[model samples]
Target: MFRKRSKTTENTAATASTAVRPVWTFSSSGWLFLYHFGVIKCLKDLDLHRQVYTIGSSGGSCAGAFLHMDTDIDEVVRFVLSCALEARSSFSGLFQLKRYLKNAIRKFGTAELPNKLEGNYEISVSQLPWLRNRRITKWRDMEDVEQSILASSCAVPLAGLPVNVPGLGYCIDGMFSDSQLIKALVLGNSYFAYHDHASVTICPFYSSRAHITPSEYVPLWWAFFPPSPEELWRVYKLGQKDARAWVIKNRGRTNLTVTPIPDLTDEPEATVLQDGWHAWENVGEEISMLATGAVARLWSALSHVLEALGWTLVYWELAVHTVLSAVVAALAPVLPDSLKAGGSTAMAWKRCRDYYALLLSLKMVLKMVPALGGRIRMGMDAIDRIFSLSFCFRLFWFLKQSA
Candidate 1:
């Protein structure tokens, strides 16, 4: 006959097993980075997928919503890519009368994104009947909650309009209340803690320098959009300070680990769609270097190739000229009659001027390509500094024009 294990020993064994499952917390910045650069898949490969609890504000929340679906990471990447392409096409048509007319007509049939997300969430939850039974009170109630969450996640001050939930008043980005990591930790602890024992290790990833600048805010309309770079800086700094303080305060009591990721916003290789690519590259490289497996080596090689392609697409400068040409064509009709005999003639002249400018810019960029490539070969930091300087010059020029 086998001897029965003591209750204390059984409890200890259970606790030990639970302790191995880490609780992953992602910041708004971290989630966006992971989503954009395909690093979320790497988490599964690294065996860090268990007990993941995500919370984010703004773009982070957008990423979180995708993650919550429990679908394949590739599916999430495809969804993000589709959304980005849609946004690009929509914005490209802003000055085009024909496209604007088409968009206006289309708007009636299309629901706002928050509504779409709410409906999607309801359908997703209904499919998972167990989750619906466990958490949802009523379908309507669940829809409302999902809507509020999506709206709040997208509530950037100037970039996104504030959303009014039934009872929450004017909800904005959740970051205004607390950093993403802190909120996730508090929620996870409250819900998952039992008998004064934590079931998982909380690992929060964040970037301290994820502040927004004035140049980064592209206005949707010609409105009195307030310039708040100073305010954004202040908030970002305060959040970083408070986050560190909170981590220190709860260090030993809570099984918390904070991982500070490098900020890639100012990097030359990053782009609006793939800003987190550099960070993901660094992570993949580090892992590949440390691991001995052939799989790791293959992943590293693929990641490098993808990074090169992404950089080429984002920085080629020809795409900028193409967009400018379209803008000129669209705006020609609105120009003063003095500019040309007719809208068609005006458009032709504008196109000619743009093409000339594009040729000149292309020549300059091509000439600098070798130098830029050399600097990149030397180190990414060097390229970043050069890019930062150019960005500052452009920002100054914009400010001068605005003033």
Candidate 2:
């Protein structure tokens, strides 16, 4: 007898669970930190089987994740127990690991080297997964760099157009204005550069051990190609446009001219776009510095002004505003946490606030597709240059005024 075919075949195994993820302050602190804290939570609960984790400083609403493989929290707790046992039995130094981590982070962060951070984080987990085989080596590839070590101040490229000097000059003139000074500072400081459009030229006035080098020195093999850039462009594997622009800008030729590239077949060559990525990635950091620095200074002044206006909760408002800013920055590519490394708690808070505003501006700009991103990036970049100069100016002013 033929059996009737069923409309549905059923075997019960629910699709893997994916919970709604929680957002973090982004790079302000990596969420991988949760793994550091979460397992401790499970250990504290004496639940071992419910938590397994992985974390990193990559992009995200969260830094990393913790998973519970088996349904039992107690089973998870066992790993933490093992780690504790190993620490007590074979690695007694584990007692001081937390202290070491705290001190190291504090020192590395602000250079002030505080004894420790004061905030506490809590996580609850049921179990611990054994540490998997992992490789932790410091091998930053050149392609990871996308940041221009040589900022606009010392290195800028012209788009090569009929630029109106008066218009550009007016732009410069406006920047020198008190309000515009802030604007310029915010934009230009990204990679600080100045332009004298009348001469149709731009120059870099800001640099900090910043150098611009290709990911790998041009391949020596390319040197044998025709001395013309067009040929070298193909053999050197240089970007179709940027490489040509660099040659023209640096070699001082406007139209395509035959140019010879140097060669040393024996010189060491690195691999890939890794360095370019790193360079580009640093753009976020530069943007943040200019943004935060401007906001911290301006908002502080604004706070005083608001206080005079008898606005209550001025400080509280500042705190809220700043936290919001930092969260926004966390979501963006990069924004500086503060003007310099290891800034004060107050300073970091200010950066966070600025980051939020910057992120908002970027989000608005991105709403219109690629145009806004490019234009805003360019405009803010100009402001960043101005910021670098103004920062120096402010320092000098403070020094002289104090003296």
Candidate 3:
């Protein structure tokens, strides 16, 4: 005969269970980062894959579809990288208005992206058997629905061509409809709880770092322009306010953890996209930064001491290298034309690699020495100052170039 568990023990067990399962929700920016940079690996590393319920719009939707399909992260990264590389190569040709319009028409007319997604990632709808009695009957119909959802998520105005769904009207960007974190949480909680009695803690990640300054905005044709610096700043502030409000509103009911990517303003490498079609041309780099930022934030949120410390070190290394590389790149453009040849580029790359290797060696040495972590932290702080100065110099250079 077994004795019954006490009420206190049951409560403790429930608390422990809840602490282990977190439902992850990705913003458009976060999703793009994960899509290109091993979302599955990150989730698995954190042991969050099985318990996660993802929600995303625009680029994030693409990630959500991949999760739903249970597709391997390796394949997702490959597909996203290939697409990014193709887009990068086609950037120059896309500058011509005629070619741009022709490509847009061809892409949207054939629902090229949606078709591609369906072909590459579609799986048996029987996996989601709960929805069998719903309007979607056949597996092909379910595939179409999933593809339509992804297409709609990525349909950014002016930047991405909209697709038409059979049942729905012309689909635009998902942000217009579902940018709020609360909606995703509500859906995830309700669906998962109903199905499995699972209690989900929301982990929301976004990449809207308030780094773009007023001075960063250069005058461009109004028709083809992004929001003004002031407007962008205002929107970012309002978004922060909204996020805070969300936290306050959801307090004590659902455990919501919000992780926003750190500002990239002081990263000299970020300026490389200044001359291009800002967001579109630098998609890969932006995605990479977003992924790194997310990882840094996630590292801070971990409960395991060893894992946290290890990831924190990784974050610092990535941060240091990013700032240093940007500084080098920024200074490169100021060099005399005679010094800007292939040999210079190769030399610069080798020097950067060697410098980073030295930093790694230093890290290993510090690990061997007791109580040296504090010294390493101090060194990081010093590097932060350097990053700030380099960023300021880069900004001044840009102003001169614009003038």
Give lDDT per model, in order.
Answer: 0.33, 0.24, 0.34
Candidate 3 residues 188-297, lDDT tens each?
11111111222321212211211111112223221133233333223223333333333344435754343342343432221211332222212233334555576744
- Whole-structure CA lDDT of model 3: 0.34
Q: Pick out the ten consecutive residues of candidate 3 with the lowest summed lDDT.
A: 186-195
Per-residue alpha-carbon lDDT of candidate 1 for residues 1-403, written as tens digits (9 for 90 to 100): 0111222321111223334433232233322332222333433333333334332333344444443344565544444333333443655422232222123223322324333333222110111112110111112343354444444343243334455444334455443433323212211111111111212212121212221111122221111121233322222233333333444454466543434423434323212211321342253455577767898877766655554443344343334534544554566577553232223745444544543443344332432342232123323553333233222223322333343
Give one digit per residue, the lDDT tens place, for model 2 in 130-157.
2111111111221111010001001001
* Model 3 TM: 0.32
Which portions of model 2 show Cα errors greater than 4 Å? 1-344, 360-403
Candidate 2 vs candidate 3: which has greater TM-score?
3
**TM-score, ranked from best to worst:** 3, 1, 2
